[model samples]
Target: MNNPKFEIFKAKNGEFYFRFKAGNGKIIIISEGYVGKPSCVNGIDSVKRNAPNDNRYERTDKTDDYRFNLKAENGQVIARSSEGYTTKVNRENAIDVVKKEAPNAPTEDQTV
Candidate 1:
């Protein structure tokens, strides 16, 4: 869909997931899991514009040389994995992070 609120993607293991901003700069997960590609695609909006919004998550917040270590509001380290890794394990890590933040999302329902 073209909705800016959320996007569904298939993980490398052929599992699917719904992801979106939790309004408070958080990310929420709506689906259990469905692996599609070998990994997750960067947000299309940020990619097409060549200006990856700071609000949206990106592999390299600083530059290509460095990767991101996804962190939660309470200082809990979520997914230290980067988008550069397209392995199933990496995709799973991303999902785990999304799930952790999803429950506390202000704009989305907690899947529990």
Candidate 2:
């Protein structure tokens, strides 16, 4: 299995954001932009801590697809699945995989 990683970067608008990548370098999730780098880092930490918990995920349906938001303990959305899943089971399994991968994922600062 490929070891996943989190890549942090600065957006064109100068906000900080991050994406979680699978070992194959495929992005699995993308976070919302933060005004500061520290806030972005905290979002990453929140995802790592909360992804493993089923209760922390808020499932939603968009059109015909399903997606989920990983939320912090405070109920703030930290990160979201990159692509909509075709089935609820697939969406839930994707969350389970994120829970397994995120804790051990290394960080790569691409903000330069």
Top model number, lDDT: 2
Model 2: per-residue lDDT, tens digit, 1-112? 5679999999899899999987767777899999999998888888888888889989998776999988889998889989998998888877877889998788889976
TM-score of each: 0.25, 0.90
* Poorly placed runs, candidate 1 (over 4 Å): 1-19, 22-85, 108-112
Top TM-score model: 2
Q: CA lDDT, every prediction?
A: 0.38, 0.88
lDDT of 1 by residue, 1-112 (tens): 2222444555566564555553344443333443442222222222222212223333443323334443433443333332344454454455444444433333222222
In the order shown, what is each candidate's alpha-carbon RMSD? 13.1, 1.5
**lDDT of model 2 at position 9:** 97
Task: Kindly give the number of clashing pairs for every candidate.
Answer: 9, 0
Q: What are the clashing pairs of model 2?
A: none
Ten contiguous residues minimizing lDDT sum, candidate 2: 20-29
Error of 2 at 108 (Å): 0.4
Error of 2 at 60 (Å): 1.0
